[model samples]
Target: MGRYILKRVGYMFLTLLIITTITFFLMHSIPGDPLAHMAKNLPEQVKQNYYKKYGLDEPVFVQYGKFLKNIVTEGNLGESLRYPGRSVTDTVLENSKVSGRIGFQAVSIGIVIGITLGVIAALFRNKWPDYLVMFIAILGITVPTFIIAALFQYLLTVKFEILPTTGWGSFKHTILPTIALAFTPIATYARYMRSNVLEVSNQDYILTAQAKGVSQFNIVIKHILRNAILPAITILGPQIAGIFTGSFVIEKIFGIPGLGSYYITSINDRDYTMIIGTTIFYAAIFVVAQLLTDILYGIVDPRIRVSNKDQ
Candidate 1:
């Protein structure tokens, strides 16, 4: 297990390196310059000074080498081109708190409600409950998140004044964005869970348990749930990474300060350091999530643990 984890971490670093390199080159290749906002009326000498300040006066390869060295020696992600003194690392850390809060709420709500709906639907297959779950899942999958956000703002805030339409810093402010973000994930987990439960129900162990006069609740809680939940856990890692980054559109519509807003702004402004930094941060989160998911697979299923140990 230790070896496996180390190997995965090694791969994660290699992946991040590749992503950083690619993002760096591609961002530079774009037509606009990071200094466009300030370069319009500046004299030649001042522009050169700005270039020197950002190390843009050097060759791209030289800049890349120094960037790598800084990362290796000091963990520096460079300063923001647009925001003056702010380092990219600090920016990500500070803004991620808001995004993380919404993501945690969304993920918790998604898993609980989605799993419960799935279980209920599976227990009452072909009944109205099953149909209702299907209908909701379909709607969630079909609707775009932005549209959902807009509709939520209109209905919940505009029509009834049930929740605040926009802003941050309070639980009431989080409600709309959290629910909007959770909608698709809830549908996703429900569909996956419902399928897994139905499949597990047909397994021979489930039949034996049922035939042995086990209580329905016990059969579900112990036998059905454990086996059925594996697939959901498998997809959860990437979903978590994506959700925690938050949706840029959702943030814009709701006026919540989140990492996504910074990320999008960085791209639009061609803030190279911020762009590369946030991308690497996102990739790291995804890689870590994937590693955790693999570890959890072994914990959840002894068969997986055994196979991994043998490998």
Candidate 2:
């Protein structure tokens, strides 16, 4: 298990390195100055100084080397081009708190509610409850997150005035955005859980338990959900990215100050450091999430560990 975990961690770092290299080169290939927004007004010497100061005048490989060095030795992500004097790490850490809070709520809501709905749907298969859950899952999967965010803003904030229209401060500010971000995952997990539950229900052990006079509740609690939930855990790895990406527009729509908002703005303004830093940050998140999911997968199913060792 320790060897497997160390291997996964090593792979995670390798993945981050590849993502960073790709993002850096891609940003450079875009054929525009990172300081273009301010270049028009600055004197030629000042513009040149800006370029040299940012190591932009150097070769790409030189810049990449320095960037990697700083990250390894100093844990620095460089300074933001858009926000002068502010480090990219600081910006990311600061705004991530907001995004983190909303993301935590979103994932929690999705897991609990999605699992419950899946169980209910599985229990009531071929009934109206199952149909309704399937309909909701279809709606969530088919509709884009931005549309859901927009409609939520309109109906909940504009039409009914049930929640704040926009801004970030209190718990009320988080509700709409959290739910909007959660919708897709809720749908995804519901389908995954329901399918797993149905499959687990048919297993020989389930029938054996039933024949042994085990109560329905114990059979489900001990056998059905336990096994069914293992598959659902794997979905969390990819869904973390989905929730964060979905939060980009949702944060913008709701006027929340989160990392996603800064990431989008950095792209538009061609802030290379901010863009690269945030991209790396998000990629790290995805890699770490997948690592955790893999660990959890092994813990839940000992066969996975044995298989991994055999590999």
Badly placed stretches (over 4 Å) of model 1 are: none
Count of residue pairs whose backbone atoms collide, per candidate: 0, 0
lDDT of 1: 0.89
Misplaced by over 4 Å in model 2 are: 308-311
Instruction: Give the range where candidate 2 is weakest over 10 consecutive residues by summed lDDT.
Output: 238-247
Evaluate all candidate structures by whole-model CA lDDT and list the values in order: 0.89, 0.91
lDDT of 1 by residue, 82-187 (tens): 9889999899999988888898899889889999898888989999999999999998899988988999899999999998889997799999998999987889
Residue 274 Cα positional deviation in candidate 1, in Å, after optimal superposition: 1.4
Q: lDDT (0-100) at residue 241 of candidate 1?
A: 89
